[model samples]
Target: MKRNNFHTHVFRCGHAVGDEERMVQAAIENGLVELGFSCHIPMPRYRRHLLKGTIEERSINNIPSFIRKLILGGPNMRMPYSQRHIHLKEVQRVKEKYKDEIQIFQGFEAEYFEDYQDYYQELLDSNTVEYLILGHHFDRSSINERYYGRAILEDKDVLKYASQVVQALETNLYSYVCHPDLFMIGKRTWSPACQEATTQICKKAKELSIPLELNSGGIRRGLREIEGVVNYPYPYDEFWKIASEIGNDVVLGIDAHFPNNFKEENYQNLELFAKRFSLHVIENFTFRKGKSNK
Candidate 1:
């Protein structure tokens, strides 16, 4: 029972309290070998001016309205902290300090958009990033353009979305698809066509030997949508069924955006999914080479 966690986040993305060094200590104490930090990428277009304050001290409502404004403005807006000095120094410091104690790979939880294809291509081409995790923050180009945690994928958009996902997956650029089933939940119903499209995408992933993630955060958030007998969020049954049928490799992503989120209940539930699906658990799969020692 190796303890490895690949999908994780840091303070820069917003929720977690402690920074990378503290997280590494927790991971070591918890008997983890690999603990990746896939923070949200810097989208300069999305970065709006905000009143700076400590995330822990700031009121949720009073935190800032910039996120909403940026979302409303569309994807062209760059990511917050794209050029922010503080974040740059923080990431560098973490990497330098923890270089010997834990594995710390540079990564991003990428947003899926038609425009994202180009942006991600640039990212992949850079060769600086070790892993890419596709987290569908928005379903379509139109509508609210908001970053709702719930999946809002429609049947008609399924093919296109699936195609973009396939491209992202097959590119051999991404390490895993974070919260891969976000679209299956939400207001849009999954149709026969959508399922078929997904099946194709799964097949492609299987061929590429890319791992599809079974995210626990969605389940923890109590956002599971009921579709037939399979639960939403990760859609374990449907997802596992397809993966098993296609022999697709599966990864369990806790998506632990917060420190307190790494708990027993959710870990047990995720393990149950692995057992139910007979999926391999790649615990302690460190992306950073030297970090697991200390």
Candidate 2:
């Protein structure tokens, strides 16, 4: 398969490491024909309150005061508006600079908040982003209410998360869904509820012709072994099995938080997972000029 990775991040997201240029170089070194920088977009400033007194606040407060201070002071969260503009400009420069060597794209891994739909539309109107991928890390439109992947554990929450993903896909605003099985992150056992929720998501994706990403970052994080059994939230076998049965389009996402994450081993693992599920993984995604790449 020709090497291509569309889901990538940079230091502006606060959690990811390395500069954008280094990420591009790493892609080239890995012999990738195409690389897309889909960094986390900065949330609107007015919505800062959504994160302030929520679960994130409690989590931050629990951290030792000094470590909390370090996290609060850093740009490791979402990029501020001004910083996002500067980052986009830099990405444009890099894309043009490496035009001949590789196909570089600028995009954002956007979270779907119903209340923030207008905010996303404004971003698109600005023409700062070339593509957007739906990365639903939270359950409710009000993310402060419930975080699906990390915090929510009940099987019922799985349906909520899957429904949110389906809604995001219905918007027709995203090129693809990233980590569609992320809702199963903390889920340990496969149950009837889980199966039903996953089926709903898979059917919707198949009907919409949306490609679900088999994220490799989950592998890099290592498998979560609960009660002597290993579980992967993304690239989750059970979910992919259903997706394959439904014949939904599948794509491999590096979800690269660092330059080194674009490794041959990760690619191999993704391929193996796809093969295990009998999935036909899409190798290269076409980049749409002024819309989400499909």
- Say which candidate scores most in TM-score: 2
For all predictions, the C-alpha RMSD in Å is: 7.8, 3.5
Candidate with maximal lDDT: 2
Clash pairs of candidate 2? 14-76
Candidate 2 per-residue lDDT over residues 188-268, each given as its tens digit: 677787899889988998897778899998877777876666767566778888998999889899999988898898999
For every model shown, what is its TM-score relative to the native structure?
0.74, 0.87
Instruction: Give me candidate 2's TM-score against the actual structure.
Output: 0.87
Instruction: Give the count of colliding residue pairs in each prediction.
Output: 16, 1
Weakest ten-residue segment in model 2 by summed lDDT:
285-294
RMSD of 1: 7.8
